[model samples]
Target: MAMSNAGNDYPLSEVPPEARKGLASLAMVLLGFTFFTATMFAGGKLGVAFGFADLLLVIALGNLLLGLYAAALGHIACRSGLNSVLMGRFAFGERGSKLCDLILGFTQIGWYAWGTATAAVVLGKYFGLEQGAVLALMAVFGLGFCATAYIGYRGLEILSWIAVPAMALLLILSMSVTTAKAGGLAGLLAIQPSSSLDLSTAITLVFGTFVSGATQATNWTRFARSTRVAVLASLIGFFIGNGLMVLIGAYGAIVYQQPDVVEVLMLQGFATAALAMLLLNIWSTQDNTIYNFAVAGCNLVRTDRRKTVTLAGALIGTALAVLGMYDLLVPYLVLLGTVIPPIGGVIVADFWLRHRGRYPLLAEARLPHYNWPGLAAYGLGTIAAFGSPWVAPLVGIGVAALAYGVFNGLTRGRTTAPASL
Candidate 1:
């Protein structure tokens, strides 16, 4: 977490080759990204909407798709040794990349607030506490959540060491208990969906839970030793780790009519277990979320004041959670799910197609002030994404890629100094 060395500049000009890691270490870090409680909540929504078979199909294929997308970016990151916001510098321009930093970073704040609010409100609920007390609890939890992010990636890796395995065991326990309550998987398959949600919407929600995070896959994957390591790590983290979260959430919803894994655990008379689950599950994600905000903020402001920026970000996100502004951000988060993937699309195009899968050094990569082609592609992609409901995020990605290829084919735009300076 001590990102004080020139070799590891704040926001990372490039991860030194000597610092690169193999599949195991990178996988561990990427795994932290998938260990998100919101994924479980999204799974619960799908559980209520579709039958057992349908739900399994949605979760598997939906996340597999996202995993592949993230892996693609991971490959790019490992090859270039660049994080997402820095990649935006190539595709979106030095100044235009700030938009990438803002959109990607602020979304993390929204997630931070939402995760904090959920944890606090539920913790308060079990105590039969009032809304005012719940708000106070949000502040307390928010501070605790910000601690790791303040330390950066090292903090995330350390927290994941204890939290990931413990959280997985609890989820498995909850599944076992719930499966028994449903008289086993056969009976669970027989349970009818309480409501109908279209397959497209369910899949969208599945990806939406982590698509923004998916775009940011480069953040951790830059640590990978090779493209193979990056790709495999991302696939395992998002596919297996993320898939399990959805399955657990779906299982809880189908058997107990509860959308929350922690709530279901509590209802099963594992109140203490639920508390542990709440702390580990939400805390693992909250710290990472705030850490992400710090990185993005540092990129946006072009500063090395990551700790100061982290504190400011935590204060802003905590205030939003306590004031209930996170509720207002939820719909926006959904819209962001549709809008943000285009950034990835353009980056993929610029990295693979335009550059032929190679890039100049980040410190010396002369780029345009504004890559209008990339921005235009993203704009068109976002519009096209909302025009239909069938796989909105994927649609955005495809449109952005195609449009970027077309626009980037034009004469080279004016080049400028790299933002890393």
Candidate 2:
């Protein structure tokens, strides 16, 4: 099949050396992508459940693990110039890759629908709009959010450059207000937990909240100019950016008993800033989310019409938002945390163990219809993760990697000469 690289984003092909991006462009976009409101909501739960110091520790440890996982994948992405879906062709085979496309694509669309609903509902309540107006707003924002994604990576980068700084300033302002209200560090430390939650659950919530996004972040990291840039950007985004969201949410919950950042801003008498924060925060992630859907859509259909797919996804997400995707956030997040990490694990194992840290060019390589080892490993990993009481995302990744390694080893041994064996 002939591949088109018209937009230069190369959805179905390798991102060539000349098209690689610098640290600032990649990092800013990733930061914007990670600055999600749902993550803040998850953090709010942790804030009320644990003591201040314990909450901090949970946030640090969870984000640390997420950062390391993303950096490892980003390193491979930068070297190979392929995102997770494209890499899926090698890990899961040409036809088998559709499993990842379907899974990852569905998750991204789910997020897009959630974000769209969130923006409309929050704005409607803030402005005292009726239900009809709120639904209309959902339709409007749903289409508007995908504008950047339709233009591809350059559009995402430009918006991120604008949104990341503004969002950062807003977060700092909200945190400062919360700090003053709590009477500074001493008072905040003295605040008792309002509820009880186990350490394991807290860590799981923190890590699981954004694991899916981290898994697909290779969509951007593949454009990194070097492996160093990719790894650093991934850490900065997943660790620092995601950590700030968790910290701010917990801080607000502890002080004002409100976990929503917009509400916190309103309580601090920054109503205008609250509206701005809501728009910027959701828009940044919404675009990235839909972009992910489009990329997965392209791979699923074997097309290069990413812009068209993006528009179609926007329509679907908008419809879902209108049909009440907002109410499904918690369960949806739980599902994401459970199912998404194993895909990354399989890709990592395929690249390092089977392909020896290098993948053949997708355009030229002849791929099989299915790779049983990867499929079987993913199944084992998913089952282990679902049944495990520990951090599900981490368990999924580890099990998937180990299973793939064992399967590959056995296959290699079976294929070896009898005399050599």
Candidate 3:
């Protein structure tokens, strides 16, 4: 299909022309906070229960590594304006790129399904509905998501702007209240259970919770005006915003010592706050899933791109929702979480190690069409990640990076390099 984009690039184009700086930054920041509530409280709560110091250490380290890779991939998306699946062509060749898209599309479908289910759960609880009713609400949410998917990135950006701040404010307010209830920041810190979390589990959860967010990051970064904004946005999003969210979880843990404090806190004074937080969290994350799925769907069809996206969203959403598998979202997220780090590892290796200082594959329109070596490397990375549950997702990521770097050295001799020196 012939594609055009006035002066700017088309939605799934390979190169995006310059855009408004503030808009780009705003979009990214908003995107960053989509998982703020979930990641912060959920991951942090797990950490505090396991061990506070250990959890903080785990979170810090995971964020640092995850941030580096996310920022790099995000920079590429921002500067190139290519939907991430299209960008994979630069790394995976044509057929390999297709496979990458399918993998990404499938994973994104899972994410969207999970997000829909989460939205349903939140809405159900807020409205005092039953599970069956929640499923109906989930369907409605899924429909809204599909509608937004059709409207494209502009709609997503607007949704991001509205939902991001709403979520953030709720997070801040909840954390503040939890802290005050606990006595203060110091008091919150002092409260610890008899059996604390181990250091490794805490760190793994930190990496695990945000792994999905990190993987889907390019969906928003593609709109960035510059690499600086991309990196800064990620830094703020993952580091600062992530820190605040985790602290909220920690604060919740400290204030409520009971077994089901997560539930209790929501029902107590934090009910309204939790509902807002839940809705915002679900919407924010859902937007990204919808956006990426749209991109992947467009790439898959390459004809009637808009219709392709709508169809893909509906089919995937319906299948998942019908399965009534909301409870499965977290486990699936954990699985994807482990799978993604390795992809990030390969991206780092490809962009940084082999390419030297330029993105030759991106610059060139064509490459050796079937890049089997890249596939092998990615496969090996996947294998490694799957086997390394103890380390969570890092195992696969590490393996993928090494395999890609070594394979690139032996086969292609590093034609492409990082855009930044």
User: Which is the leading candidate under lDDT?
Assistant: 2
Off by over 4 Å in 2: 1-8, 413-421
Which of candidates 1 and 3 is the stronger one according to TM-score?
Answer: 1
State the displacement of the C-alpha of residue 131, model 2, in Å, after optimal TM-score superposition.
1.5
Global lDDT for candidate 3?
A: 0.63
Cα-based TM-score, every candidate? 0.94, 0.96, 0.85
**Model 3 lDDT tens row, 148-261:** 556655655666677767666766665566667767756645766555656556667666677656666776676667778777777667765565566556555555643232
**lDDT score for residue 133 of model 2:** 100
List of clashing residue pairs for candidate 2? none
Residue-level lDDT of model 2, residues 312-331, one tens digit each, is 99999999999996577548
Candidate 2 vs candidate 3: which has greater lDDT? Answer: 2
- Best prediction by TM-score: 2
Error of 1 at 231 (Å): 0.9
Residue 284 accuracy (lDDT) in model 3: 63
For 175-247, candidate 1 gives per-residue lDDT tens digits of 8989999999799889988889887888888877788988987888987888899999999888888888888
- Ten contiguous residues with the weakest lDDT in model 3: 1-10
